[model samples]
Target: MKFASLDPASVSPRRSRRLWPWLLLSPLLLIAIAATLAVQSRPLVEPVDGGLKPEEIQSTKDFLRRNDPRRLQASPHRLLRIEERQLNLMLMQLAQRYGQGRGAAQIQLQAGTARLQASLQMPALGVWLNLEARLSQTLALPQVEELRLGHLPLPAWLAEAALRRGLGHLALSVQAQRAGELVESLRFNPQELLLGYHWQADSLDHVLGAFWTPDEQERAQAYNRRLVEISAAYPPGSSVSLALLMPPIFELARARSERPDADPVAENRAALLTLALFSTGQRWSKLLPSARAWPQPLPRMVTLAGRDDFPQHFLVSAVLALEGSGPLADAIGVYKEVADSRGGSGFSFNDIAADRAGTRFGLLAKDAPRSLQALMRVGLHELDFMPGVADLPEFLSAEAFQQRYGGIDAPAYRQMMAEIEARIAALPLLQQANVPRL
Candidate 1:
């Protein structure tokens, strides 16, 4: 019985040893078998580097081909259909290059009754650029209106160029319509449709050419020149740019021509008043006595007044008097007339008290007769008799006026007088006045 038990134990150990060997070798054995089978079934496998495989490249090419809907052949008369994706991509490139990190939404193109409409939203600027181009005309006159180009942080140079050159997309729309109409209505040489863009600002128009021929360098130079000219003409404190001054200047010019008394001081005052009215939307005619005198004072004022009979003649008379050899003389006469009517003596005095009290000219006091005398002593200076006293402080205190008319070493009082004189001389009537013999 002992011999039988020992024999059974020996058998068990042998089985265990056999199972351990199989478990360890199974993984390695299976891998070797797979490798050997692969080698025998196919040719030796080549090492693949980092590049795409031939099949993968082929698949990419196929995908592009499938997506491309408008693959037009090279032909003289070809109606190329550009897919929305393609247009959007092109616009994306443009926006990336010029826009301030703003992405553009999908562009929509549609055929209208007589034109083509291309619309897109600019995400960066929060504005929509809608281009409606006439497709029927041969010359292709595209009128581009700004639906909303304000939100974009447009570079000044770009803005100026835009004013000069037509906006590219809008121009293209017009050309497309023309081309379409030409294709449908008339027979002519079929040329490739050209696209362009332009800006409404004069500075931009000269700078940014249409897409077909964008002269970027030239436009930039032109913009710089314009900026320099504007700076020189308006040097700080002189006045705003001529463009800003145009409305008032034009109105004054027209009034001078139409009025019987074209008083430069009065005209200047009127111009100022008109400008104030325009800015504030307030009627100031009630502040003056001769609101209805003759030859309407200024066109804008007349527009503001909504009246037919304006003081054009009085303005003309004032202008003639101011322009004559005696501008100060004319002013003095007007002042005296006003003062005398109010029972005040028309005499040059350090202080004049009116007999009558409470009316516009009832009480009179001279704050600085010495300053006035000093200005009058300078033969080149002329002071306005009517409303002339009110602008004295501005003339005295403004640095710009002082720089132009007063010497640097002059006393403050002298500078003030000189500035006042210079302002008076700048008036059209006073400018025409003969220099008094000192």
Candidate 2:
């Protein structure tokens, strides 16, 4: 320590020499910092108006998490769990990417409406462009009102004048226009945004028909009429013909299989049985009056007595016939029981069992090829008393039903039956029963 001369003069020159580069770079560093802040603040939507309660925020978050339309299986009207800040940040990033320069927007929840304010930052010129608007919708027609740009009001008169001059038509999309037309009303509450639509019996048919050419529409109408006739051929308000019911089940199965988000096998099984009950308009709860079909626990493995009279004896028998004894099976039993109680009934358990040799479903269950038997069983299940379960277009009217599933004679119906028959012939039935049926 004594050997080294600690002279201030000597150290000061060395320190100053080392600091020169940083001192020279200080202006660029300050500029960078200023630029970053300016970029972040440009067209910023600050959380200034705090009206939402803690509970409201929590509930809204929960609702959004539970119900996102992006989730295919989710309900149509759902809240998004995303926070306003994050959403604004995303919008800003998107705007920046698109050369809009830090376009930040924010939402403020108010009574029956939301206020949105956004800004665009011109970092080069150190200037900010601001926009303010309120969201107010009529029916499903969402309109952005009170739109202002840089303190200048965007008047309704301007829009009306533009429309009058044919400068631009309302700036509303075709989809928005159609939604406004279709939706009867719209509601926004603390809970969620709800759009109410009135669906007439033939509304869907008419909507679908709109997509078809005149010749195609005529053909579809004729085909649909024929299918309705076939569906209506079932005995009025009694037993469902599983043979006739097979076509819809087949269509449902195909559709279910196409859904990537679903368990197709399980859905197909449940849908088949549910549709069968719908076809006959029968409820499952009453099928077994002595047994508590619903509001009771189902066994993990429901052991069916090795009796051919089984499935025929119970509308849910078809579901019970599935290969596995798991949650799906248990759900089927419970749903079937509930469905029987909720829907229109045609036959008692005993009546269906005894008529095994007489009715089409009974005969199919009794003596048809094992594949067909399994198909019938797998396709049929009890319906649950849930919204939108039995709203099959065909079931709305005999005419509609006939137009969709026109029995064994209709080409689609015939094709489905033939395909199921071929599948049964090709594949062996899964062995589900532990005991042999008598």
lDDT of 1 by residue, 80-107 (tens): 3344445444444333223322223233
lDDT of 2 at 4: 82
TM-score of candidate 2 on Cα atoms, chains taken together: 0.25
RMSD to truth, every model: 31.7, 22.7
Model 2's number of clashes is 27
Position 258, candidate 2: lDDT: 59
Task: Give per-model TM-scores.
Answer: 0.18, 0.25
Candidate 1 backbone clash number: 41
Best by TM-score: 2
- Give each model's whole-structure lDDT: 0.31, 0.40
